[model samples]
Target: MTVPTLTLNDGKTIPQLGFGVFKVDPEETERIVTDALEVGYRHIDTAAVYGNEEGVGRAIAKSGIARDELFVTTKLWNDRHGADESKRALGESLEKLGLDHVDLYLIHWPTPENNNSVETWEAFPSYRDQGLTTSIGVSNFDHRYLPQILDTGIIPAVDQIECHPQFQQIETRPLLTEHDIKVEAWGPLGQGKVDYADTVIGEIASAHGKSWAQTIIRWHLQRGHVVFPKSNNRDRMAQNFDVFDFELTTAEVAAIDGLENGGRVSGDPAEVN
Candidate 1:
């Protein structure tokens, strides 16, 4: 299956659907990542905090896939949110990933309470120029914080966040669009919290003869958002990638959109630090 790519502000392209290793055990990372790549996933999202970059690197190296054929993304952790530290942290991530450069690098979370996000964001352009990262963006950013960064006239290529049907992030979407930042969903499956067997998603899945996961992923795709659903299970990983065949109708899309409760399953970025 061919995954579509989103063009970044820096003129780079990223696969719309990616594989995420957020909580995969370090020991299991290589095996799972290898399975994902074998199943046709070209994008892999890891972070320094995930503690699995080394495993991801090993898997990619052993897979025999050319480095240029894969899209790798790593993030700068909150504590490492400073000018010099951001650059150094990315270097550390690159070393762990066993690559000289990454396709995309993101500020994991904008810890506004700590008052360091602005300084860290300011440091991103230098990283891009240094050739350490092809594109730079932010994660867990909202309407309030996004403007702060964009006001500097530096439009981030993408904004990765906790977006699922339950936590649609409607208010933040326009802001990202206004700044030409592509919205990438982090916890697209609600971290497995929401019942995929629910009537809404299930009914749509039945109509399309696809799994609920596939239905939800199709929803994200139809809406033009980048989505990465995390799973260590090989079959489920393949199932997540099998979303290119069907399209959800407008009414079905509305029903899924109506599931939004403005709830977020992950820790609030404002309080993470």
Candidate 2:
């Protein structure tokens, strides 16, 4: 099945469904990413901080897939928040990934205390100008950081955030909507906080003759948010990518969305430095 694509404000397109290597072991990233690629995933989300850029690179190299056919995303670690450091970090990430350019690059965090994000963001256009990355964006930037970045008049094409059925973003998403920022959900499966095993979600999955995971992924797609659900298991990796064949109804989406009860399993963007 073919995954749909979302066109970013920057005139670039990203696969609406991809694979993530967030906490995957460095030694295993190559094999895991290779598995994802074999499962028809054209997008791969990795980060310098994940310490798996080389493995992700290796997988792409071994796959022999043309660079233009794949979308590779990486980020600048929070500690590397200065203008110069931001440039240097992307250079290093490109080196490790064994690619001359990445499809997308993002500021990993706002690092609200040091307050160097604006300068770091300012340095990104040069990377695009120089062809180091096609698009630039941010991650874990809440309302506080969003306005600051917007005030600089350099809007990000995408915002990688922790979003799932249990912690659906209602308030913060509107800010992205207002600015036309595409939502790329980081922890799209909720990290076990809300699994497909739930009665409501499982019932929906059974009704559709799909797995609960597929049901949830379909919900993310229908909501117009980009999703990258990660998995090391080969079966689960293929299962997550098999979401294109199904569709979730409006009532089912609402029932699953109603599970949101302030269930944020990840760090709060406002508090995490």
Candidate 3:
């Protein structure tokens, strides 16, 4: 199965359908990650805040997969957003993952409320130069916050955000496209907040002989968004990656787009931070 790829701003290619370890328990990380690897997931997303880097590292080592075959992403957390701390936090993540370099490193949140986002954005590029991380980007950043970072003359390779049918990020999409920043969907399935078996998605799934999870993921892919759906359940992890076989029609895609309600299930980064 050949997974599709998205070219980053820096010209790096990322698997469009990757595996994510957002809430996977630390203790079960090794086994679950090992299973994901066995199931054919070459890209893995983790964060310093997730506290499961060690287990991910152990799984990668035990899987015996060649290092170049994997694409690993880790992030810098809110509290460690400044230049010096951002650099140190990435180093710590590298040490924990037991890898010399991460395929991508992200700013977990703008945390503008913390009043240190600028300082942190200023420091992100040094990672690419130092060879600590192959690419650098941001998460939970909106149209407002994104320009602030880009105005610094450094464009992020990707901008990951909470994107699903309910929260399509209508306004932010153009800004990202205009700047050549690839948009990645985090919480692609809405963190399971929206019922996957709901009528609309279910109907689409049944028509295509695909799972609702696969249908939603395909919607994101057709819209040119990179996605990583998290699932510790072995079968579902495999199911999520099974979306490469089908494609949604223009009307079917529009129907899904019409489901957007401007609702967000996750906390607003601007407010939370």
Candidate 3's residue-wise lDDT over 152-264, tens digit each? 88889999898998799998998898988888899999999888668588899999999888999999999999898999899999899888889999998998998899889
What is the lDDT of every predicted structure here?
A: 0.90, 0.90, 0.90
TM-score of each: 0.98, 0.97, 0.98
Cα lDDT of model 2 by residue, 153-244, tens digit? 99999999988888777777889999999999878888766655665888998998988888888989998898999999999998888787
lDDT of 1 by residue, 89-123 (tens): 88899999999999889999888877878888988
List the candidate 2 regions with Cα displacement exceeding 4 Å: none
Q: How many clashing residue pairs are found in candidate 2?
A: 0
Regions of model 3 farther than 4 Å from truth: none
Scored against the true structure, residue 158 in model 1 reaches a CA lDDT of 93
| Model 3 clash tally, residue pairs | 0
TM-score of 2: 0.97
Q: Which residue runs of candidate 1 sit more than 4 Å off their true CA positions?
A: none
lDDT of 1 at 252: 94
